[model samples]
Target: MSTNTVAGVRPAAEPTASQGAAAAFRGAVAAEWTKLFSVPSTWWTMLAGLVVMAASALQLAIYAANDNTNDDPLDDRGIVTVGSVVIDSVELTQYAVLALGLLAITAEFTSGTIRTTLQCTPARGRVLLAKAVVAGAVTFALGLLLGGVGALVARPTLGGWGSAPAAGTIGDIVAVATYLALVGVLALGLGAALRSAVLTITVLFAILMIVPLSLMEPDIAVLNRIADVFPGVAGGHFMAGDTEPYPGAVGLLLLAGWAGAALLLGRAALRRRDA
Candidate 1:
């Protein structure tokens, strides 16, 4: 045991494995956050997404208002389904979050910053995990803002069509935000594994939209059952927040499972593949 003299106390004890891992994760998060904010594309994408959401919401509200005869207020029959009117908007705009997630990781590779990033965090899994956290957080925040504002703006018109959600407006809005976060994180994991922007985005799109639709054949019960587990389908069901093919709890769990498995796969690929 080497001990320092000259009025110097013994060196600080080394951290345990768990402590070391926690510290590393924190550092990785800070680094990834810096990288994420430095990019101009993120700002552009978020701006574009918000613009689309606002436009669509206004259009829906206007259409609803015009449809009424002699300015009679609409009932709660059509406007309120599966929770809040905002939920429909939240679910429809899910693709934006998925794209944001893919870009969070794939952009690094596209810009050749991935090498530098891996060098900073040699533990590839830590890098992927940090990206997931950052991306998921960003999507959640965006979801809240979009869903809350869109819902509020359109609520009066939508209210005529249906009653307020039993779950409360705030709860439904927050649930949509959480669902966006989960979907975003899953896309981040797929980005890490694919390491290509185009491929990751296409695959995510297919999983979220095309696959389930294509598999829906009136005669094929088994195909529909298989589609039930896809992260997008499961998450979409949850967003409906009402009667669904799968229970709400099961839908959430399935979405979580997809994100976790994809993250693990990404970690494995990051470790094994050349940067």
Candidate 2:
């Protein structure tokens, strides 16, 4: 046997700190961030939310301004613009956010890139988290911008129909933005769990839209009460400051429960499924 070991047969070196699994996750997040913005649909959805909100607010403002009288000029205008327009805008723009959330994951499934995503971030949970984080952040920022701009634009047009929002209006705006982000994250989780955009979207639409309409009956008072705790219902209560049916804090908790349950269920499915 040769006294010296062959150079080519030297012992394998230990993995470097840079090569650790945590580093891989950080890289995955960065790549995911880039991939999220690179998609054209993302920008389109965001723009749609902003435009719809602003346009609705502007229209309400103009209507309020034109209808203003000596007795009711600015204050009345403010109420119509903020109360009616903002509610309508929230309902409409949320659809765009839903689409964005659904596409965030379903597109990967359609394109067969989910496998590649899993390969890079094998934990599966981390992948889900990364998707939620990116989608949630974007939706929240857009919601805040849209809401703020809508409020600002409506301010000038409120001849007497509107009043300036109180000092705590910022808190209300923040709540709306937070709600939007939570809804987006919930949608993303649902998408991942279903892995089919059409099915997920349809289910979401029915839950958010149809159920509430259908349950508006005297005979269904109990059902309506239960449905009031649903995400959409709770969201409406939050935006309008309507605590007749449910207290504000209780409504918020109900919404939080919906979000948390959806997230947990989706995470479990993501972990168990084939990605």
Candidate 3:
């Protein structure tokens, strides 16, 4: 150790292992955020998702209003609440967020930039974690935006006949945001594991929509149970506060479990595979 005699001079100490790891994680997160926002697709996807949400919400609201005005209102259609409208819009337009998450990680692989990324950050797990964080955060914000816009667009029309319970509507919005964030994490995990944007998107869509739809029949108990646990169904249950099969919290937990499982698989694949 050299003792510096210069005024206000001191030798800098090396960062501890934990501190180094934290710094590396922070760097990775910053890099991922930069990479995600630097592209035009992110903005375009968000805009498209917003448009779809607004359109869906407006249409639903108008229909509800029109039905209420008629003498022979459809009793089969349950009360059209703000929460339902927002959640329904989100359900219809979640593909944009999923696409965002898939592209966040797979773009690197597709463009051969993942090799450079791995070279720069040798700890593959940290890179994946960072990507998950970035994708989750962006999708969460997008969810909030979409939910808020849908509510605003629907309020004028819905006020004529639909109900807008403050607590329920706010809960639904927050739940949608949480669901979208976790869904993004799931997509990130798949993207990391597969390293192909197209394949990951297709597989994610199937898992979220197609499989669940195929198993939605109530007559098949086993299939219904399996479908209820899927991410899309679980998210719907949580956001809508459904009590059937299980409580809303259980649905959130199931969705979270799915995301966690995907992340573990992604981490394992990332560590074992060559960049």
Candidate 4:
């Protein structure tokens, strides 16, 4: 009887060392992280975010020092420290974080590097997960650094009117960090799903900026509620150091929901579309 295998058929090729290297999730994550931090934009954007936060806080401190108000100590402190800067600085910083996050995924698409990335690790979900982890960690660290410095610098300038942030202030700092990180993840997901940086950034800006402003009208209570669920608004509530109609935990959960939904959508897009 003829052999079942074709005459030219050979034994299956052994997995190469490089392919074997990416066997674990941690290895894959490390590889992706190396590529991410190596990009120049990552450093530039991070530096810019830090600078903006510091400058805004400094400006507020100078102004407060000049005015030297004794009214409502916390308000004076917030003014001198937080400065005249609105939560918008934090919101703007989110845009930079978003850009870095989008580039994390879109860079692969733009350079056709994603094929190589996939070849090294065939699981698409893992690739997305790795990107999310790296982006989230970086953004979170930067957020904490920026927020703390901003608060610290402003405190003394405000004539020490503002009491030191309570232990709960740590929670607020953590919330800001979490918000920045989640926004980065959300942008990564959008970039992956859309595979277009401009489109992703535009959509994110609209969702985070325009939507909130438009919904703030008194007639738009329902829309306002919906907009409040976004990371920008939820983050605003946390950084504002005030209670809102919604519980702080609820705001966090809402932000989490946005991040989770975006990630799921990106994953679905990845599975459905060709690289």
Each prediction's whole-model lDDT (CA): 0.78, 0.76, 0.87, 0.76
Colliding residue pairs in candidate 4: 81-154
List runs of model 2 lying over 4 Å from the truth.
Answer: 1-25, 62-84
lDDT by residue for model 1 over 91-158, one digit each (tens)?
45777667888888888888888999888888887888888888888899998887777776776655
| Top of the candidates by lDDT | 3
Writing each residue's lDDT as its tens digit, candidate 2 over 31-105 gives 778888998988888888888878877886777666654475454433453544555567767887788777889
lDDT at residue 101 of model 4 (Cα atoms): 87
Q: With candidate 4 superimposed using the best TM-score fit, by how many Å does residue 90's alpha carbon deviate from the native?
A: 1.0
Worst 10 residues of 4 by lDDT: 77-86
Lowest lDDT 10-mer window, candidate 3? 70-79
Q: What are the clashing pairs of model 1? A: 74-160, 75-160, 75-161, 76-161, 76-162, 77-161, 79-161
Cα displacement (Å) at residue 31, model 2: 2.8
Q: Please give the clash total of every predicted structure, in order.
A: 7, 18, 0, 1
- Give stretches of model 3 more than 4 Å off: 1-12, 73-79
Candidate 3, residues 79-158, lDDT tens digits: the string is: 67887888888777888778888898788888989999999999998999999888888899888888888888888877
